[model samples]
Target: MKNWIINQSLDHPGRTVLISLILTFILGSGLRFFKVEDDMMKLLPQNMESRKTWDKVKEEFGNTEMIFIAFGKSGESIYEQTTLTSLWDFTAALEAIPDVEEVISMASMNRMDSEDGFLEINELLPNRELNVIQLEEIKTYLDNHPNVKNRVIGQHGDFLNVIVHPIDGAPNDILAGKLLDEADIYLGAYETHFGGAPYLTGVISELIRNDVMMLVRAGMVVMVLILLLNLRSVPAVGMVLSVIFLSLFAMTGSMGWIRGLTGSDKFLFTLMNTSMPIILLTIANSDGVHVLAKFFKKFRQTGDKREAVQKTMDALMLPIFLTSLTTAIAFLSLIFAPIEVMTGYGVSIAIGITWAWILSSLMLPSLIMMKSWNISSRALTSTSILERFANTIGKVVLQAPRKVLMSGLTIVVVGLAGIFWLNVEVNIQSFFKKGTKIRESLEF
Candidate 1:
């Protein structure tokens, strides 16, 4: 197998490159179909008891998710006439939104009392404009009805919360946007915050999309810079980047293909899977770097590009294949994970690693054969700073093997001990930084 690959790459380098590009393009075309999965419930185990109960609840109650819009003023009461007017207006606007089943706020609530020994129920805010006495009456009613007050008002009477319930299967993202727009129009002077599962779902979806684009681009840029510094050749860096890009394209595109073929969203990208591209970038780059470094060293010795390519493949092929295989197997272990999203993450990443190996073995070698490298005697004889640094570390390890072993063991021991202190952050809010709008809204 190795001889066949080497021969094809050397004898018909163009054909080999053409085949690789054709395969990459065909597989990568599916990228347009890729979609993001932001529903956190999908990440949970389908058969879990809690999950089953949640599903049952949703089945009976129909989208129990609510979007809470809280209005407040710093160091002031929400019972003022102007604040009450704005709150009433905001409640009406929210109720007008499509898919909104109910809107609960101080303005929307009913006032219950006894008039002429008969029970009476009337609008909590009968008019948008309230007099001073009417404002005090509302305040007195809230103070008496603690349960109702807790639902619509803040703990300290500083904020009024409007809870909105949307119909089942409603698009929360669109609805949240409309709700926020109305809040801006009606309660622009007051401090406003949003919460509840529906609002969070919408915000997290946008964040996931942003993160996928930003992190992948950033990772690619950083990898290119590092490759340039280490390889010190534009062609060499390009070859490595080609493998990385092709691997990522194949990985993401395969997801779309899987979903299209099976009609299942199980393989869709999720927050947990966001790191897959970065992982592939690092691993794919490693394989290409190994091939290029070995080829360069061999070419310096033999001064024959063809012989260097053949010998480089012969020496490193088995080792690189085994490394990628073992890494993929390690990730494949996640197939047994309870959560469906994690299982998908494992399978997708495993496929990515396999593709990376294939490209590094075939495409990279073919590219090396096609390109002409200019290697001066000075360049051949002189070692790079990275090589020197590696050599220095090798010498230290060889000179005091026992001391090095002890230091490594001690570090591992400390890491093991530190596990006890490590906290598992399951809060979705923790995904955002402290001052981020989403985090602040959730905290509020």
Candidate 2:
């Protein structure tokens, strides 16, 4: 099979490259359907006891998700007339937003009082503009009713909290955007912050999108620099990067395509998938580097590019295939994990590794055959610093096998001991730095 592929690629390099590009384009187009799954509960196994309970609660009652907004000016009491008026307007604006089922704030509360042996209930802030006496009466009522006061008022009267409940099935990202926009318009002069599970989930979705793009770009730049230093050829680095990117597109695009075809949320990208691109990039680069290194040596010996490609594939095909297979199988083990997200992560990454292997074996050889090389004498004869470093380690192992074994065992033992003291945190807020606005809002 390897020989057939190698011969076909060598026999018609242009046809091979064209076919690969066409396949890649068709798969890459599926990227248009990609989406991020931000609901943390969706990542858990559906059949788990806690997950089942949560689902049951939501089905029986209603949307339990809450978004908390806190707003006030520093050194200003929320009981002031202007502040109360602004709060009233803000609450009304929030209630007007679509999908918002309820908005709870002091402005929306009802006051109960006894008069002439009868109990009566009235709007807490009946009018948007409250005089000083009316504001004082509301403050006194809050002082008597600590539960209501604590829920709506912040510590030391520095701020007021508004709690919003969205209808079931409402999109969190859309609701969060609307809520923030209203806050900016209504409470623009005051200090406003937001925090809640729903809000954090939306924030996480954005962060994941940003991180995926940032990390992949950074990884590619670093890989290109490393490849240039080692391969010392612009064309060689380009060939390797092409394979890497195609494999990435195939993997990510397959997720979108699968979701579209199956109409299932199982394949949606999760926080766990943020590392997929970098992983595939490293593996694909490894295969390409091996092929190029071996081909360069063979070409130097035979002075024939075609012969070098054949000899390189003949020597490397089995070894590279086995390595990729073993790595994919290792990741495939995650299918047995209890978390649904881990299963998707495992399967998607395995697909990526397989794509990398295919491209490395087929498209890389075709690319090599098509590109004319001006291999420097130094590149053909001189060993790179990496090779020298590997050689030095090999000599140490050969000269002192017992010492190397003891060192390896000692390090493993230390790592095992450290596991006892490890602390695990699942809070999304913990992912951000202390000074970040999201982190501060969460803390507040």
lDDT of each: 0.85, 0.87
TM-scores of all predicted structures: 0.91, 0.92
Which window of 10 residues has the lowest lDDT sum in candidate 2? 375-384
Best of the candidates, lDDT? 2
> Candidate 2 residues 1-444, lDDT tens each?
878988977999888888888987787777887789889888888889999999999999978889999999877888888788889999999889888999999888898999999999999888999888888888999999998899999878889999998888888877878887898898998988998888878778888889999999999889898888787778888999999999999888877787777766677898878998899889989999999888887988888889999999999999999999999999889889888777767777788889888888888999999988765656666776766687899999999999999999999999999999999998877888899878999887
Report the error of model 1 at residue 385, Å.
Answer: 0.8
- Model 1: lDDT to the true structure: 0.85
What does candidate 1's lDDT look like per residue over 1-444, in tens digits?
889988888899899889988988888777777878667888888889999999999999889888888888977988888888888888888889887999988888899998999999998898999999988898898899899999988998898889999988987777878887898899889888889988887767777878878988998888888766666788888899889989999888877777777766678777778788888889998999999888888988898999999999999989999999999999989979887777768777888899889888888999999997787843355666776788899999999999999999999999999989999998888888999878899898
Quote the lDDT for 328 in model 2.
93
Candidate 2 Cα deviation (angstroms), residue 193 = 2.8
Q: Considering every candidate listed, which one attains the maximal TM-score? A: 2
Candidate 2 stretches with Cα past 4 Å from truth are 73-75, 117-119, 377-382, 391-406
